[model samples]
Target: MDPHDRYTQNNFWQSSQAANAALTGCYAVLRYSGVYGGAATPLWEETASPNAYNYSNSDGWNSIAEGLQSSTTGGIISSRWANCYEGIGRCNYFLANVDRVISIDEATRTRMKGEAYFLRALFYFLLENYWGDVPLILDPPDPSTQSNLPRTSRQQIIEQILKDLDSATLVLPLKYGSSDLGRATKGAAMALKARVLLFEASPLFNTNNDKNKWKLAADAAKAVIDISSSAGYGLYPDYRSLFLPENENNKEVIFDVQFIYPQEGNSFDLICGQYNSNAPLLDLVLSYEMKNGLPITDPSSGYRPDSPYLNRDPRLYATIVYPGEVWVSGSNKVTVTSSWFPITGYAMQKLSVYNSATKPPVKASDIKDGQSYINYIVIRYADVLLMYAEAQNEFIGPDPSVYDAVNQIRARVGMPNVAPGLTQDSMRQVIRHERRIEFAGEGLYYNDIRRWKIAELVMNSPIYTWKHTLIETRRFNPNRDYWWPIPQTQLDLNHNLVQNPGY
Candidate 1:
């Protein structure tokens, strides 16, 4: 029996409304579990790094951190691959058919195209970051011709990603009105470009220590920094509030994945606050500098062993829930106990909505499962500043601009500026440390360590609890762990697919 009025690819793009809805479908992919779709998956990524520990292996990150992942590893390794390709497919379909809707205005059509280009580039960037060389599919899938595609060179994919980002910047607006707040913008495209260049220039990918690559990354970051004010981007005044639901789309956010409660929400608060899935490790807790911008190891740092949490960086109080700190849930003041966090003795406070200062504290019962609506920030101004500082320091010696960029971030948290006259080597150490502390629990350290070729050094060490009790030993084989293995299922489907080395 033939269907009477079903919409197919040929009939769907006949109107502007349908085309717009199709474009929205492309954005919906961002919410997928493997993507930034939910808070748990993104924040749980910290478990794969030294910043945090995962009590369970259901999420797949713990295995990766323990260097136990293989081609057959099923959780995140497989899902991330599938999700990125799904997003890429949606983007390809939208780009191929959106122009067919003649009712759309010329300017709107170009802008939508720019948004699609930006999204496609974003998906490919994720693929290249994790899988190294992924199959680059530009057009809508045609089964007969595309079923057995070979992996494209990562360098080639990155070149195309840059091209798409450049095209997006040329056509996309700097920012949008409130109605379209989460849509891709020129600033977002530029910021993503800078991140891509910085990763490409890192030691993992740039083994030769090419100064030119660092210069390129620095220049790209500077371009975004130069336009930041006009584009309405800056550091949000309060670091903790920046992740609160009410403060979403704030000035600090360059790009974020939108989530609305009761419709499409995430389990970030429940998992992080109530369940404590990703527990902050003792290694990361000790990384925060003293209030005066000195390491705890320093003789004059004023760090007392008995009062380890006091007189520390202000950001520490804003980001972590340690013993003795009161955690308010529905008017109930519960001081954290040693048994509160069984795995690491710490919980993250950055992305949860449980502020103790609210007139009526939000009830943990209210957001028990997936009722939270806080947007996951993909890129922010503070990150751009850090990127700029790191890239510039690598390109040239510790310059004044490098110092200024990093100092701005420190000053935001009321911490002292880094000392003057630091040599390039010293400045490198400072910037790397700042990144670990500044972006902790944000799911970035895993990549930072890998790109810096320090994952083996860090991950091979033993993980411990707050009391210095050994939890478990970790291993990182530099030959295999840096690039995740392509999923075993994908290889089974395609004869041309080859597994990553040592997997």
Candidate 2:
């Protein structure tokens, strides 16, 4: 609630609507323009990955991608740190004050508090991903006491996150009413915990390659799958249309940053602009396999460089605009190049509502208005399935459950299932590839490559566009690039702050 609004009603928290609004305010943090909201968001972190690149060096992600990120680097690093902590602060404030509201029913109060907890854990998770260790503040900070709080280890933070999610599951409802569609749920908490555990068990954190850790991660994911029906969670049928605004609250979505153009003054179209920013890179285009479930590089796959877009994975058409692809802008049917020229020769088609068959799709005008309502999905059922496949494959070689999970994802997009009797190592490769294509432009690529320890191999070479146009000779200093430096401004604010090594 705004301070002016609070001033008008001295006892705002005593009213149910006002109290609910405070809880809603905690959620408002997720819509921060720099994180999940506007053009450059957490997804912009993808630019640091080999999956995509920004043509402009001034682009925020380019600094981190090119190994120039420093304590003073004020793009994604500082924005995320500031915004995420802002979100955590909001959650803290809500939790500290919500108890004083007597008008809210006990059930609603518990659920609202649970949502605040989940949102807090999520903000911390984002912090840990970029900057390895961060100061863990549960309650609203007391300037008197927290003026010089030190950083907490990532492992301890993860433990606290799991505790929050566990507590959340005990009170959060299985689903929310339509009026409260985008609020967090029990399934979302579980799914997020599964993701954290999987990341915690990965090579980066689990340097010992402990099988027990993988089993723990697999079990956590399986817990989410086990509650699918009760939680109203399943795969949405149309892979291409899943991100559309009309399908915002589908069963596949566990948690999403809700956005509505004009109403919220936020646009997904503007987030991934025409060709100026966040364009699909050539390396990503080549990663998609053929329709027949064979890689383009395989001799028997029937891939021809001269006509590369033909007979490729169905997802490729749904994801990128190849040279000859038809693109609809307003009522005009024109090739993609006429409207947008991708620096990498491949324009982004994911999350964009355009088609040659229909002159004005329901969302056509939103793009032109810089107003799109597509909710940015954070955790979806597909991710759970893929995480389960990865964890289970690591825990025990290929098994029936592993195939069952992987096959469900393939069936949704009309792709053939993995052949039976594959070794654990082979299945690992398959699961990794499946995740790459299934979530191409969704911001998970950076997390995957980092956890799998493959960023250095892929990012150290010169990158070219589809037309062999050289874009950049990327650099990755493995010694210091894995973790971003603590912001210089932050260090100056708190003398207790410690910078990451090599900063």
Candidate 3:
């Protein structure tokens, strides 16, 4: 097993361990620069939305935030396209060789193959979400014969993804042992299918406004919920504690970009320091409702402008560090002060482990050495519930099941549910708001806003801080900005690749 040897007939498929490592190697692509590879994972997408602002020139995110991205200029634009293909290629290669290893048991081999299929589908899903249509390479094509390819329609690619995921669902197990914790499972495949169906059924892609599309999405999500009892999936009790390392494999997480410390891993807390990379903005802070289940604009909501942080939803405190929040650093309880004068006058607190006597020491040594071991949760039960609520509402109008699903989320965070009886349209708005607040710093808002057909409406306007201070004005060309342009390097390498319309 020479390290430099290429994956071939002579090596990598001879032993059960080699087969498993090769399969694990396919997942390594998730750690590529544009995906969940680095500390600024959330910023790569968050800055592109109105959710957060990269005040400093820390990364290429600020350019994306301003909507000044060009196919050639924006590094993330190119990185995302290339990295996803890299992951897909590994998956293809693994799938090609998985059956060669006869040393592994039938069940183990099937599950390994299932993981590869799910990962390949996931890579394609990421590509389609960012760049609407992309080349669909199902196998590792020979360079001499298939060096160039053309983009496939997003719909066609989605159908392929569903096919792969369905195959995956049959082979993958419901759960794995703790040692094999982060591997893709049957629920992971089903949850991802639900997500893909929901996105495909959104306004941005579902241009025909088909009611059946919404029903399809709703049914896919419900499929995951139906097996929740046996699958052992539910929301973690404390919202704040969910992101901590000790709770990495909690019941809430359906699937995650797996990571560990003192190995090939994460640097989330360090990058989101005082000069936070994915810093929460005032607009997001204002989006949280009062403790009494009312928007700030409502007279009975008891939201005070001057004391904005008081008596708010508990999640608001969990997710953001405002003027007076207490922050712990190596046994020292330091008050959060905005000394750098962040663009939005706020700093990100989510995904960071605060140092305290009760927890492991999260001091300077821990952060400097990249020892933060928090796994970035890609999907969780909370998101599944929200997706089910949204899709079900759109399909059959406001039903009791829809209310129960949403109320489950609200109850976990100790917030009041929607007023007893509401129309379908109003409940839609409620679900939308819940997603925004619930997933504030988690990098899902960008896709949520875009899919809901409101990116132009929210992004085009000037964004303000908590005190009505204008921070940034964004540009979103509804006709063109919905999908990022395919990278120029890709177009150069393959002439068949067409540039996105606006680019």
Give the best candidate by lDDT. Answer: 1
lDDT against the true structure, per candidate, is 0.88, 0.81, 0.81
Of 1 and 3, the candidate ranking higher by TM-score: 1
- Compute each candidate's TM-score over C-alphas: 0.97, 0.94, 0.94
Question: lDDT of candidate 2?
Answer: 0.81
Give the per-residue lDDT digits (tens) of candidate 3, residues 1-503. Answer: 55655755577589998888888878887763436767347544676777787766444666666777778764677777777888888898888888888898998888889999999999999999988888889887466544578889988999999999999999999989988988999999999999999998888888999989899989999999998889999999999889878878999999997777667666677655534666677788888888998888899889887788889998888777687666555666756556533556676667777522234324445465355668888999999999999999999988999999999999999998778789999999999999988887788999998999998888886777645678778888887878888877888888888888888
Clash count (model 1, backbone only): 1
Q: List the residue pairs that clash in candidate 2.
A: 71-488
Give lDDT tens digits, candidate 1, residues 270-346: 76766787888899989988998888999999999998998899888888878777765566676777686677788
Model 3: ten consecutive residues of lowest lDDT: 355-364
> Which predicted model would earn the best TM-score?
1
Residue-wise lDDT of candidate 2 within 111-156, one digit each (tens)? 9889998999999998998788889998786777776889999888
Candidate 1: give the clashing pairs.
31-37
Q: RMSD in Å for candidate 2, one decimal?
A: 2.8
